[model samples]
Target: MNDHDKHIRVHIVDDDPADFLIIDELLLQSKRFQFEVNHISSISEARQELIDPQCDVFLLDYFLGPETARDLLIEARKVHCPAPIVVLTGVESGTLDDEVIQLGAADFLPKGDMTVSLLERTIRHAIQHKRAELELEQMVKRDPLTGLGNRLLFEEILEGSLARCKRAGTRLAVLFMDLDRFKEINDSLGHPTGDLLLLLIADRLRSVMRESDFVARIGGDEFTILIEDLHDAEDALNVARKIIQAVSQPSAIGGHELNVSASIGMALFPENGDAPIKLMQKADIALYEAKRKGLNSVQCFTSNLQTQLERHLNIEKGLRHALEHDHFELMLQPQWDLRDRRIAGFEALIRWRFGSELIAPSDFIPVAEKTGLIVPIGEWLLQTACRYLVKWRELGVSHYRISVNVSPLQLKTGHFVETLQSTLKSTAIAANLLEVEITEDSLLDGHEENPKVQQDLSRIRELGVKIAIDDFGTGYSSLRYLRQFPADVVKIDKSFVSGNGGEALAEPEICRAVVTMADSLGMDVVAEGIETISQLTRLRAMGCRMGQGYLVSEPLAFDEATQWALAGEAVSR
Candidate 1:
């Protein structure tokens, strides 16, 4: 290339014209390169040029008037400046060089030491290094599989979009979408097939984007879109509808026809939230609402949703606090031996005390599971239950064992098995003294296929701990789980045993079938929700050997339970 063809446009930000002239003379002496230097005298003017840079290189004075270049450098990086900046100073200080370099400058140079070759080389190297960073950053912003923007790019562009909309007095929307039942596809069809399906979906998403819309993939099956519409967000809703319809259509992947639906949540700018993170969070919450409503649904952020979110956040914060401060209470519900009409064992239930408000497990347990705080909370429960069980055994309470309800999330973590083994060994409690109860639904969801799940259950069984399938017959494939899963007890769900209409107990046939099946499998049956004489009589007649409900006694505190155990009262009466 000729020297004139190798042209460079440089911005020189310095207040002193004499300093600019000296640097300008040094550049004039270079024969290998052509230079165009524009001198900027004020920091306020420099701010404007930095935001919309049109230069290959920027020469910023270390001190411009009363302010340094630190704030300008921060603003440039925040907006993602494409050009490299070399900080210039008349003072020869190595410390200044290091400080300026750390603040996003391409290089540091003392202006008094400049020469023709030194200036040319420093400018070329700075430009090359900045170009390399920009190239790497471009690659980092893109989602590799789909070639769409990733989360980092989304956040970067989101701020710019917000700024432009604010200036124009327009509105923008954030759309958060998650593919419905994506895990099922991944598990059944294999990851390669799932990836093919994702690529197809991404192409369809690209086909629906407008000129002002930016699309990105931030999760495996999650996508986000930014829509800058002039007026109200009807355009965003239309896009959501298009995505649901387009994604729901069947696609042929690897000779298999597969279909997936999208659940989209939309949050408007300046209304749902004023900032990027808040706006995205609100959109995600809306997406969750759409998923809850059903497949292929679109939902908007609402105040009612905010209220619910506030409660969830409150519970989440309280759970973390409880973990730190030891604010949880373990309540024990007595399990009765129906045939013997006496207490057999106990089911350990956890309760939260948040200030004066007593929160039931039904209230906070869902939040804990959602936040993944259940891992530590669940471990604490197990440890406390084992400690109490040992105390009871030492006191010679006439109970068989304590059954602790285990969350499916806890088992999925893969550390629960090790934690259980450790707790058992440390407490010096026999495996028979503790029974682990998992919901029938968790098993029905193909959890048994997971190696971690299998390892946990098998290892626990190997340790001689009994397993009980709690809330039986409540899930779609509960009956199917029974064939593959081995358990010592089956607790029939309350919905089947509770009375409805004129019938003394609802779904008597279901209860009879469950009891009969458990018996055939040599698994003991516990009929839950026994709240009356008639229900208890019918369950005992159905050969349900053990049960627990308010009819026997409500869940009691530690002291109350210990007292009840020592009393050895008849629970059936």
Candidate 2:
């Protein structure tokens, strides 16, 4: 049909017959548009007419027998009328126009200035403006990358769902999902491939979701699902499992075969939390626990998880305060040289003193790493160890080095080399007397290829500081990785040293291989966790030069470690 031939239904509500006649004549005079007008004389009639979605536009007079256009406009909005309402006023005051417009009227028209062309243009403009407003609202609620609902819409939906569940005495579930190893993939391949993978995973998620369930992409690699009207808690569990399986499926993107898995955490309504924020937080805690266990797993929120989350938050707060004040101390464990039969160096270990309780490194270091507090904390340890080395030199202790463990996050910081150089310049300690120990996994974290990482390592080595791979034979123990890494020492992990019980010496094949490899590469080897004499003797016989464990001495405070160094009794037996 032609645009002019299509009838535009216009509903007019006015008590005065002359006003109705004027509007009717105006519509009839229009040549470019066809209109079918429905005139109602009372508020009751207009309310009933607005219920049926027939009218394309609404024209209501400012006054209709004991009721105003504002009253009828509010009622129309309650019923969600799609047609736009334009107020017809006898007075041409700006205040009246603004009053009507604020009360849900699309626009206002004056009765004296009425013309066929003006009336037609007003109706078309009102309809188009309202449509654009609605479209903009929808666009704001969607994710730009995945075309799924974004975090803002997810929060809105959660608030509404929680209110409904509260009234109906029903249960709801909030599932927080995070893609595992997504950053590694993004860094290894590229962001474009990562974006494609996210889109594919989003499609997979939607394919398995029910019509009533809602899903949203709340972060770069995180999504949230809201399942309402649950009959039992098991229903939520079933949905979480289905999502895990669906997300685990392999997908090919950008000519690369990619496999991704999700860790899901679920929290139920009224049991886990009553508010939207609490529910989301609890689900996130459970999600982290699932990730800790491994990927491709589902974990449900429990009371213990809540307690742990609280404790973790407290620890994070306390750590920040501890770092600000001087609340951390360092202990040194001696590393004995089997060839020289004397103490070679000590590994600097950090300890936190929270009030009267002494928090072990095992308790607080992981929290520091996760919260990015490790960067500052590691710097503190580095400076403290170097200062100690300077003190030992002043005491006439010669031919000894101090080893300080470094976190992967610390090295990832772009200023690590600068920080080390500044520390050395401040302490004036010889660089050769300072050794930095990095875990095996840290070296495998794109260190060989990452120019920033390689540059940092190279600069540190240029300062004459020795680099040792700690916890060897535990993670990424590839011979090629070790050969490519610019390191001077390899510390065989305690697991291999103590694997053979205190019986007849059963040689550890891994230990022998690691020693042989380090020897060929001109790297010194330190055997860690050598508690028994048999373990020590076996390690010494295998050409492992340095050893550190309870057999030498437990991690000692500064004074005790200095006494052991001066006494020269590290291998008294």
Regions of model 2 farther than 4 Å from truth: 1-172, 176-204, 211-232, 247-263, 274-281, 291-297, 446-451, 499-507, 569-573
Tens digits of per-residue lDDT for model 1, 101-138: 88899888888787889889989999888878878987
lDDT per residue, candidate 2, 1-573, as tens digits? 467535688888899999999899999888877989988898987876655547888898998888899898887665556678999989768698888887889998899998989998998888788778767866999999998998877877787677668767999999999999886787677678989999999999999998888999997899999999999889999999999899998888888888888899999998998888899989988998999999798999998998888877888899999989978899999998776658888899899988888877787887898899999999989988887877777888756788999887777778888898888888888889889898886677647436577567777889999999998877744666577778999998887887565532344888999999999999999988878877777878888888988876889888888887777666343
Instruction: Compute each candidate's TM-score over C-alphas.
Output: 0.80, 0.68
Which candidate has the highest TM-score of all?
A: 1
Instruction: Give the clash count for model 2.
Output: 0
Clashes of each: 0, 0
Model 2 clashing residue pairs (backbone): none
Candidate 2 residue 116 Cα shift, in angstroms, is 12
